[model samples]
Target chain A: MARVQANGVDHHVQVLPAKGAPLGTAVFVHGAFIDSLASFYFTLGPQFAEAGIDAVLYDLRGHGRSERPPTGYTLQDFTADLDALLDALRIEEPVHLVGNSFGGTIALDYAVHHPERAATVTVVESGPATQDWAHTMAGALDQATEQLPPEEALDWFVAEYGAIASTRQGDGRHDAHIRRLGRNAGKFIATTTIARDIPDGRVLSDGEVRQIRCPVLLINGSEGLVAEQTAWLAELLPGTQVRVVAGQKHSVLVEAAEEVGALALDFVITEADKAAALEASLDAALEGGRTR
Target chain B: MKAVKATQTPPIPDEAQVLAEISEMIMSVLGDYAPPEGDAAITLDSRFGDDLEMESIDLVTLSGRLAEWYGPEVNFAEYLASLELDEIIELTVGRLVSYVARSLRTAATAAAER
Candidate 1:
C-alpha cells in the first residue's frame, strides 16, 4: 500500500506490476461510499498483473484510507487526485483509466476532458452522467439514512448491498459508515456537481463520440438497470465494446471479478493491437503518398 | 396521430395480422421480457409489471430499443409516457405499419391524379 498526499489528503494506493512484461498501467478510481484496495481491486488487480498489465488501485477522497476532510468531495477533486497520482508515480505513458459506478462516471468525464492523458477508458456498471439518476440514488441513500435506525439501516444496507460495499464484515464500521452517510448528506449532496455540470453529457453527438479516439468498453450486470445503457454506449461510441456477465448485478467488479478482469484485459490488448495496425497503415500511406 | 387510411385497392390487413406483427417485433426486441402468449388480444390495458413481470429497468431498455427500431425521428419519450405496455406494444407496431401504408396510399393517390 502506497500513501500519497493528493488534494490535501493522504490517499492510499496499491500498485501491482506484471511479473516480467509490464504492458501498460491501469489506474482504478473507486466508486461511492467504499474505499481501499481491499475491495474489488484486491480481487481483480492481480488478474491484471497476471495478464502483464500494471494496476493502480486507490481509495477516493473521503473514503477508506484517504484523508477524510470535512468537505470538498466534488468529482473535480477526484480528477485532480488521479492526475496527481499519475505525475507522482512517474507514469509518463497514457494509462488505462478504469472505474466502477460513480467512479466510472468520473473516469468518463476525465477522459472526455483530457483525451490525451488516457490510453483507453473502461467503465463497469455505469452510465452517462444523469442528474435524475444521481438525485434518485442520493435520495435513496438519504431516505435509508433517515428512516432506518443507524444499526438497522446499516444491516439493511449490508444485507441488500453488502457484496457491493468495501467493508468485509457487517460490523461497527459499517454502522459508522451508515451514520456518517446520514450526517454527511449535506456535504455529499455537493458531490453531484458533475451531474449538474454535464446535463447534456449523456447524449453524445456523433462528432463528440467520434472525438473519443481511445477505445472504450462498458461492462454491465446481466440483470442490472444499466445494461441497456451499456449496450447503447457500446454501439454509440467509436471503437467501443460492451459485454455483460451472466447473473451479475451492478457491482460487476465485486461480484464477477474473473470475468470482468478477463474482459478488461481483452479490451486493452485488442485496443493496443488496433492502435498498432492503424499506425502502421498511416505510416505506409504517408510513405506511398510521399514517394508519389 | 395521423388518420388511418380507408383505401381498399391495396386492402389493409385486419387487426389480427397487425397484432401478430407486433408480437414478433416485441419478441425480437424484448426477447426475455416478452410474454410467451403475447398477441393482439394483449390489450393496451395489459400491465407489463403485473402481467409480464417487466421491471422498470426492463421498460426503460424496451423503450430505448423501440426508439432505435422506429428511428431517431420518433418522439420516444412522449410515446413512452402516453402508452402502456399493451398500448405501446400495439402502437409501435401499428405506427410502423401505418407509416408504410400511408406512404403507399399517398403515392397511389398522386399517380391517379397524374
Candidate 2:
C-alpha cells in the first residue's frame, strides 16, 4: 500500500505487479460502505497480476486510510480521487478501470465523462441511480439495532463477502481474515459519509448513456437486487456486455473474483487493441495531411 | 419524457384470468403465504407491500418477471419506481396486459409522465 497527498487529503493506493512482465495496469476503485483494501489484495488484484496486468487499488476519500472532509463524498469526489491517483502515478495511457457495487457506479460515470483516459470499464453488480435509494438506505440505517455485537456482524460480513470468494479461492484462510476485517469494519460504517451521496445525481441521463462509447462488461450475481439492474443497464448502453454468475448475489466479485478478473483483463486488452488501432488510423490521416 | 399516448388497443379481453396469473406469480416468488383470491376485481385496488407484502426487492423481482412477459423495451427501473400497491390494484390485470403488450414506450413516459 502507498499513500499520496492530493487535494488536501492523504489518499492510500496499492499496486500489484504481474509475475511475468505485465501487459498493462488495472486501476481498481472500491465500493460504498466499509473500506476494505483486502478485497483487492485477496483476490481480484492478484488475479489480474497473474494474468499479466498490474493491479492498482485505492481507498476512497474518507472510508479507508484516506483523508475525509466534512462534505463532498459524492460520486464526483470518487471520480476525482481515481483520476488524481492515475495522474499522480504518471500513467499517461488509458488503463483498465474496475469497480464493485458503488465503486462500479463511480467507474462507469468516470469512463463516460473521461473515455479518453480509460481502456475499458468493468462493473460488478451496480446500476443507474434512483431517487429513493438514499432515503431508503437512510431509513434502513436508522432502524439498525445494537450494531450486531461485533462478533455477529463479523460473522455476517464474512458469510456475505466470503461466500463469493470461497467459490473462487477454495481456501479457508480467506474467510478467516475476512471475519477479522469485518470486526474492524464497524467504525468505517459508523463514520461513513453516505449522507452526501445524492443518488439522483448518480443516475445517468439517456444522453449520458448514449455517450459511453467505450466497451463495457457488467458482471452480477444471479441472485440479488443488482443482478437484474445490471442486466437492465447492459441492455440500455451501447457496446456493453453482461455476465451473471449463477447462485451469486451482490457479492459476486468476491465469490467469483478470479473469473471476474479474467473477464476484465480480456475486455481491457481487447479495448486496448481497438484504441491502438484507432490511434494508428488517426496518425496516418495526420501524416497524409502533413505530406499534402 | 415521452407522453403516455392513448392506446388504440383496449385492456386484455380476459381480465380475470390474467390478474389471477400475475397474482399467482407474485405469490410464488413472495414465499409460502395466503394471498387474496378471486378475479379481476380482486386485483383492482389491492395494496402493494401491505396486502401483498411486496417490499421493494420483491417488487423488483416481480418487475423482472413482468419485463420477461412483456418485452425488453420496458424500463424496469422507471416502471417499478412509479408504482404503488394502491395504484397497482387500480390497474386491472387487463390494463397491465395491455401496458406490457405495447412497444415503443420511452423511459421518460414510463417514469415521469405517468
Candidate 3:
C-alpha cells in the first residue's frame, strides 16, 4: 500500500514483515506483461511472513500501480530499480531474491552484478538473461503486441478459457481481467520501448554467469519452457539445487503454489539460519581478536 | 495545521455504513471496468470473482483503500492471511463488511477500556 519513488519512478510496494523475530528478508520479483505484485501477494507473501521471513513485493515499472514512462525498459533498468528500492527501504542486510519468469532473469542478473547484496537466489521457471532468452522474449512480445490490440483477440480468450479462468489466477481468461489485460498490454507495447529494449538489453556471458557464488535454487516444472536449462545452470553455478515439479508447466508458481511455497519457505529458513550462524562466528572472531 | 486532540475512541460504523464504504472502495478500484449495474450490483452474496470479475489483485487495491479510510486497526492483509486460498477466491463483499465492522468495534472497545 506504499508508493516509494525509486529510480525516479513511483513504484508501488507492499512489505509483509516477519511474524516473530525476523529471520531474513525475501524480495519477490514477479513476471512481466500481465503479471503484478499481487501474484505473490496472494500466494507467497503471506506464507513468507508467517515463516519469520519478511516478504517484499512490488509492481514492476509500467506493469501495475507503478508509474509507466514511455521508454527505459531495459534489463539493466530493472536491475537498477531493485538496487534503488533496497536503498530507499534502508535494508542493508543481504536478502534472498526470489523471482518468477522474466523476473527471475532480472534477479539472476542482479545477483551477478551485486553478489554481496544477495544471500541466495531462487529462480522459478526462468533462466539467466542470455542472448537466446532475449531472442525468444522478442518473438513472444512481438506476437503479443500484434495480436492483443484487436478487440477480437480478447473475445477469443473469453470464449476459450472464460469458464475455468474465474477460479484461477493469471490465466488470462476472466472476462474483465482479460479485457483489461489486453487493453493494458496494447497500451504498454505501443507506448513503451520494452519490446525493443528487453531483447537488445545487456546479457550475461558464460564467465559472468559463473561468478555467482551464493546458493542458487532453480525450480521448474517438468514440461516448462526452461526445464532443460536446469542441468546447464547447475553446471554453471556451483552451489545450485534443482527441483522439477512433476506434471506442471510454466505457470507452476500459481498452479503449484502450495508445494512451491513450502519449498521456498524451507530454503529461506535454511539459508537464513546458515547466514546467522556465519555472522555470529565472524562476530565472535572479532571479539576474540579485540580481547587478545 | 489543525490542533491535535487527546487520544479518543472513534465511533464504530454499523454494517450498512461499512457496506456502503466498502462498495465505494470497490467501485473506485474497478474504475472503467465497473459493472453497468453500478453500486447496486454489489450485494451481500455477490461473489468477488464471478459477480464482480475481480482478480486477486483488486483485493490488494481495496485493502489499501480500507487502510486509508479506517487506519491500521483494520488490518486487511492479516485478515486475508487467516483464510484459505479458495475462501479468498470465493470471497464476498458482505464478508469483508462484517470483518471491517467487527474490527472497528473491537478497536473502539479497546480504546474505551484504556
Candidate 4:
C-alpha cells in the first residue's frame, strides 16, 4: 500500500501517476463500514490517471492500513483528515472529489465548508449527512448489533458481502475486501463507537447545500437507498444534476464500475480545470537537468 | 541561468539486463508469497496488478528501486503521474523498458543541445 501520513495519521493511499500530460487531480473517498479505498483503487482510479490526471484513493481512518486510534469518526474529523491530506501532499490547487456512500457525505460537507478548494463534486449513491441518515445508520447498526458479537456477524459478512466482493474481483479471488476487513474484523464488528459518533442527522442543512459553488454530478439507481435524500439535495443546489445509472442501487459503485469510470472520465475532461493541470504538467516535464 | 543540454545517446542498461534486474527486484519485493512469474508471455503489455499481484508496499519499494536504476531522466513516478489508472494496470515491464530507452535518448539529445 502507498502510505501517506495525513493529519498525523497513516492513510493507505494509492497514488496513480498521470499517463499523458497531467490534467487535474481526482481524489476518491470511500464509504464507511465494510467499504475501503480498495474499491476505487482496482476499479476506476487508474482510468483517471491514464487520462493524464492525478488519482488518489485512501483508506479512511480505522478502515484499512491507517492507524485506527479508537476515536475521531465524526464528519468534522473526516473532513479535517481530507484537509490535512491535501495539505500533507502539497496539493495547493482545487481538485475534483468523487465519493461513494458515507464518503460522499464527507465530500459534500467538505465542498460546502471549503468551496474554494473544490472544483467539482461527483457523488455515487450518496446524500448529504443528514439527521435522517444518522438515524437510519444508527437504527441499522442497532438492528445488526442485536445480531452482533463479531464472530457470527463476521461469518455472515464473509458469507454475504464477501461473496459480493469476490464476484467483483471476478474469478474465485476472496482477498481484497476480506483481507482488509479481516484485519479489522474484530475491532469493526465489536465496537459501536463509530456508529454512535455518526453525528445526528442533517449534518448539512438545505441552505448549506445552496452555498456550494462547484458543479455536482449525483449518480444513483432509480431506487438508490438514498433516493429520498437526493431529491432534497437536488432542490437545494443550483449546479446539482442527477444521473441515474440503470439497474443499479446503492451498490452502484461496485456493480457499475465501468460505467462510473467512463462518466468520471468525461466529467474530468470536460471540466475547465483540465487546462490548468495540463499547463503545469507540461512545465514539469520540460524542466530538466535536476541531478539524480 | 544558462542551461547545458545533452545531444548524444546516453548509455542505458540492456533491455534483457534491465528486465532481469526488475524481475529480481519484484521477487525480493513479493518475497515468498508472490504468485507464479508470467514467463515468455510476460511482454510489453503485462501490468503490476493483473499480471503481477504483489502487495501494494512492494510496488512502492519497486518504484524506488526503478528510480535508482534508471536515474532522473526516466522517472516511473513522474511518468505515472501523467498516466491513467488503466494504463498503470496495463503497464508491462517491456513497456517500461521501452520508456527508459526513449527517455534516455531524449535526455541525452537535450543535454547535448543545451
Instruction: Please report the candidate that would top lDDT against the real structure.
Output: 3
For residues B1-114, write the lDDT of model 1, one tens digit per residue: 112334455444445554454445445545664656635345434444344444322433443443343333332333343333234323334453454345445656775799
Write the number of the candidate with greater TM-score, choosing between 1 and 4.
Answer: 4
Weakest 10 consecutive residues of candidate 3 chain A by summed lDDT: A160-169
What TM-score did chain B of candidate 1 earn? 0.41
Model 2, span A104-166: residue lDDT tens: 878888887788987788887776553444455455444331446655665666675655433
Q: What's the TM-score of each model vs. the native?
A: 0.58, 0.60, 0.85, 0.66
Model 3 regions more than 4 Å off:
A146-176, B1-7, B10-14, B32-39, B71-73, B78-87, B101-114
Model 4 earns a TM-score of: 0.66
Clashes of each: 1, 5, 0, 33
Docking quality band of candidate 4, CAPRI definitions: incorrect
Q: List candidate 2 segments past 4 Å from native.
A: A18-23, A68-71, A132-136, A145-183, A195-202, A288-292, B1-114
Which of the two, 2 or 3, has more TM-score?
3
Q: Which candidate, 2 or 4, has the higher TM-score?
A: 4
The lowest-lDDT stretch of 10 consecutive residues in candidate 2 chain B is B1-10
If chain B of candidate 3 is superposed on the true chain B, what is its TM-score?
0.87
Q: A140-240 in candidate 3: lDDT tens per residue?
A: 66655565655654555444333322334354333555566656666676789987888889999989999998888998887678865677788888679
Would candidate 3 be rated incorrect, acceptable, medium or high by CAPRI criteria?
Answer: acceptable
Fnat across every predicted model, in order: 0.00, 0.00, 0.30, 0.00
DockQ-superior candidate, 3 or 4? 3
